[model samples]
Target: MTASGDGEPRPFLVAASLSGAADADWARAAAPHVDAAVLGGVALDPVSRAAARDLVARGRSEFLPDDPICWIDRGFAALADAPVRPGVNVRSATLEPVREAAAVCADRDAVCEVNAHCRQPELRAVGCGESLLREPDRLADYVAAAAETGATTSVKVRAEVPGVDLVAVADAVAEAGAEWFHVDAMDSERVVAEVTGDTAQPRADLTVIANNGVRGRRTLAEYAAHGADAVSVGRPTERPAELARVAEAVRAWREGELPAGEPPDRSEASP
Candidate 1:
């Protein structure tokens, strides 16, 4: 839903980057505390699914045996009546599965997030996750493919990748038609402002959501000051206490009750 008079989707606290094990029940549990939830980093196509299987064999948890498309549909179906906005984070070595999953998400009015943040060796080897970061044009192609389905498209990315310029990556995806830029600002919090700030001229308007270490008011306020449209909790997604704290913090920030540190000098904030 609209969070302000600007017609932008409300800045929300989300349960972020949960694994395939996250299902309807998990979404339901997180719904009480989060405005939105991203489920699955599920492998979508056969090649990626094979890679996922290899990962599972090496002790990774994934949505296996169940078809990726079906899994996404089932997850959304279960959340049909829930108050929380639903999103599916998907992984695939090919464009087809990305398009297919985005179609399901489109029909359900949910966000279709492309997983560009996973650093797993198996996933990276198959050209799925962080591998996409190094190939910005390819990543843009994936984002464009997902956007074609009429679903709200998001790309989950992380900072600190050697040789990768996140601002450039953000620009590429936004130009490719992504609506959401989900940043896992690992220790580099100010990068949120770098991407969200108005300095990037001719850049498509993007809803920036900062992820990582978002526990309560302080962290939430910190990202806000950095120009994040929202904040999300990653590792603590299952902890009710943590989730509640973040949810409340988000509410306070949205209502202008929390102090987001000094505004950056707009003149110096540039990509």
Candidate 2:
């Protein structure tokens, strides 16, 4: 259930995210490779977060589930009650929904995150995801509230958002009490990989995680060295066999054989 660990906690190191493509078969496929499974970005509406969160929980076998964004308006539409962990991929720090989402995350012992990486056209029009990283001050406030919830607070940010100051944003997230940060290095065409190079590692205060296109232990190791405390996977868990491969990747990550890339120096981890 641990998302961030010191030296290859699971050998492969996978934090699988369950998106619309998830199901028992998919969950079963990804279960073996992943230590924890997080539900993909939801509508931030409470109902959306709650329903999505429940689905993630059900799909995951034993692993803990953390959902993204608790769509405020979607709360009433939730098929289930609120989950302990709420998700936030909001771009506007001043949005009132952020406050509502924070409160729900606090009340539920759930982990809440700020999704600063989604670039969906509709999301951009609404100013969510990557757009939020531009305003560190407001994002920090939301992170603080989420942390105050007694649940692990984290932020999943999309990189290369132009005016984005990686270090400053990471520093802000840390100062606000966030324990984990999700760095999406994937390119738009590739779903966030290919663009990763550890540019944001230096700014984090707590555990740093790299997502977007982590394939095997080699890639995981390269990321870990670049200052990641952990790494996550998304579409790979589309089915049972793939999920098993995901688990095996975690085991390999712990063993120190990540998919080939720039292997980060195993020096004192940048806290």
TM-scores vs. true structure, each candidate: 0.91, 0.64
> Candidate 2 — which residues are off by over 4 angstroms?
1-19, 22-29, 45-96, 99-109, 187-205, 256-271
Give the poorly placed runs of model 1, Cα more than 4 Å off.
1-9, 199-204, 262-271
Which one wins on lDDT?
1
Model 1, residue pairs in steric clash: none
Cα-based RMSD of candidate 2: 9.3
Q: Lowest summed-lDDT stretch of 10 residues in model 1? A: 262-271
Cand. 2 Cα-lDDT: 0.52
The digit string of per-residue lDDT tens for model 2 on 177-266 reads: 877677776533232223223345334336666775565455555665555556676765554454455456666666555555655333
Local distance difference test, each candidate: 0.82, 0.52
